[model samples]
Target: MPYLAHIGPIAAIVAGVLILVMPRLLNYIVALYLILDGATRLLR
Candidate 1:
């Protein structure tokens, strides 16, 4: 799962940038991350 491992940091960075550049996107980014994370965990 090298791709998955690589994406984790990239996602974090994107979320960080979104938070910095447009604070409004922070909530959407966080919600998306959480939903995806939960889905992945549950599916696994």
Candidate 2:
């Protein structure tokens, strides 16, 4: 998970793994990813 060095990246990786375990969580994960990414971009 070297690519997932940051909190956001780590969350993304965890989300991906969670999705594999429970496909229903994909929507939530993607939504969260987008929200976090958007927040980071906007704040930065």
Which candidate comes out best when scored by TM-score?
1
Best by lDDT: 2
lDDT of 1 by residue, 1-44 (tens): 44555555677788888899999888899998777666555554
Supply the global lDDT for candidate 1: 0.75
RMSD of 2: 4.4
Superposed on all Cα atoms, the candidates' RMSDs to the truth, in angstroms, are 2.0, 4.4
**Please, what is the TM-score per model?**
0.69, 0.68
Clashing pairs in 1: none
Q: After superposition, how far is residue 3 of candidate 2 from its true place, in Å?
A: 14
